[model samples]
Target: MLGARAWLGRVLLLPRAGEETRMAQSPAPIPCQPTTCSSSMGHKDWMDKCVCLLTAFSEHMRRVPVALPEMVHAFSAQQQTLKQIVICGDRQAKDTKALVRCVHSVYIPNKVLILADGDPLSFLSCQLPFLSTLRRLEDQATAYVCENQACSMPITDPCELRKLLHP
Candidate 1:
């Protein structure tokens, strides 16, 4: 299990321009360490779970508005370079996990707002008003990639998500 310092250090090492400023202005990183899961789970599984938890925690930390203006200034400085990739998927679906792992592997959280929820349509509609028309499109798991507010066709295959994110 990685310590908070180690996880924060790794996040800091990423090539985000004003990330340091944002981190300074935001609340401290979550102090919790990754706890071991079931013994049957592989190391990769444990690590993935840890990463997801940390990502969620970091997102929560960013909600503080104490230094909103400064944070916005810092974020705007890098806005042109960062692509706001909003990924939406059903949180309970197996394919949603796959899509999340794919996005995390390729894009930095600083560059993308990856939003995954069991009710993605409701979640995204509230977060991104432009996606009010977006829907799950069936019971099966699906993913939608919206770059800078322009959404692509809903994707049902994880491989297609990888291609869309990387390409």
Candidate 2:
């Protein structure tokens, strides 16, 4: 009985060569330049694309277990020559872990902005008690734009998000 149990354990513990190889290998993603806006495009068209791209990226990051690695692999595969990539956020400091994950995955080439949402003044004054702490945490990045916990710059002008992405 003991011999049989030992045999069973060995069989269960054995790693298939093919499975091991596959597990060791990572998937490559379609890479693009770091943060170059797709040029020769109109503002309306650009905005549309930007929204779509951002939405897709956000969704993927939210869902995938190893989202950062996949994003990095994709970016590297594309050899994306980026000047910078801005990440617009609500600036709760709650998402700092996710931000750190992003930092680990991508090599910060130029700048990465973690922008806040909504109106900056109220969020800074009323809600965020550790505003200075939040800013300091973001000091690790290229810049941290605050606007009501939303992005103050990139999408500030309403259409800039769209324009920057497409046009």
Candidate 3:
């Protein structure tokens, strides 16, 4: 794994500080907007941070911006396990069930599509618990996809969500 300093540097971009005071005085690094971590932190760190951040956001939905708790709760309540994901709006892809269900395609808006495939790099980046719960189920062995918490899978067409769920 890359060193934290390198990772932090790449993420923050500001020069290293000579003192702890400087570190504290520095403004909280704005959430890495534009998802530039791909270029600086390299692919692994970028993906890890994405998952970690999304996961944290999902776990703490009330504190994060643009998160939907009800959606997350509903997703978690489902007894079915998911494998794939399909992202739509800025907060659309935040579902975990899709990833677990091995969803084949995602319909993402231009605004939220960040990674090379318009998918969140990590499950931790999820701000919604539904997505977070699904992500928590994901591992090297299972395929998963998400954005915020709304997730479903067993789909072949981007416009075929109607086939997957009763919504």
Candidate 4:
């Protein structure tokens, strides 16, 4: 990542051939168009902010930018419940990635994915305590769709998970 950052003012990805990627003149922090955290906050703080923004933007449908940013805070507290999907399996396995891809395809904005690969990182369960109890059902990749921390039955089929998320 640092290697990429080193080339900051030197290169940019253009949408079309021979197009100008940036302005001739700009303020400090020359390349601010795309940034992870442009403030004094450290990496973890920036990551948490990114996750929060992702959660907020996921709520808007095909379009919402036409409205003011205030729409995000306008929602009632009760309606802001987060939906967590915990996947317990070998995260490196091809099948596990496929399941995660399917989850990413869903339009539901409040959803978040947590991968709990078991023992070596069992301490992870301390952060998300439910991971301590949930395991691979039937010895296969399993997904638990939980809302407000209460989950529906363990899901082993991608289609079943889709139905639960969308319909």
lDDT values for all models: 0.49, 0.35, 0.34, 0.55
Could you give candidate 4's per-residue lDDT for residues 1-167 as a string of tens digits? 12212233323412223212211121111122112221211234433443454455454422544322323332322245557788888988776776788799898755568888976457667655567788888778888887644888988888888889888
After the best TM-score superposition of candidate 2, give how far the Cα of residue 160 lies from its true spot, in angstroms.
1.3
TM per candidate comes to: 0.45, 0.22, 0.23, 0.54
Over 1-167, each residue of candidate 2 has an lDDT whose tens digit, in order, gives: 12111111112222233434322332212112211222111123433443444446655555553435535543443343333233334455444345434444554443334343434475532444323233322333222333223433322222333334333
With a 3 Å backbone cut-off (N, CA, C), the pairs that clash in candidate 4 are none
Arrange candidates, best lDDT first.
4, 1, 2, 3
Which whole-number lDDT from 0 to 100 does residue 34 have in model 2? 17
The local lDDT score (0 to 100) that residue 157 gets in candidate 2 is 29
- Which parts of model 4 have CA positions greater than 4 angstroms off? 1-78, 120-123
RMSD of each: 14.9, 18.3, 14.7, 10.3
Candidate 1 vs. true structure, TM-score: 0.45
Clashing pairs in 1: 91-117, 91-118
lDDT head-to-head 1 vs 4, winner? 4
lDDT of 1 by residue, 7-82 (tens): 4323322223555555554544332222221111123454454455444554554667543443343334233333
Off by over 4 Å in 2: 1-21, 25-78, 87-155
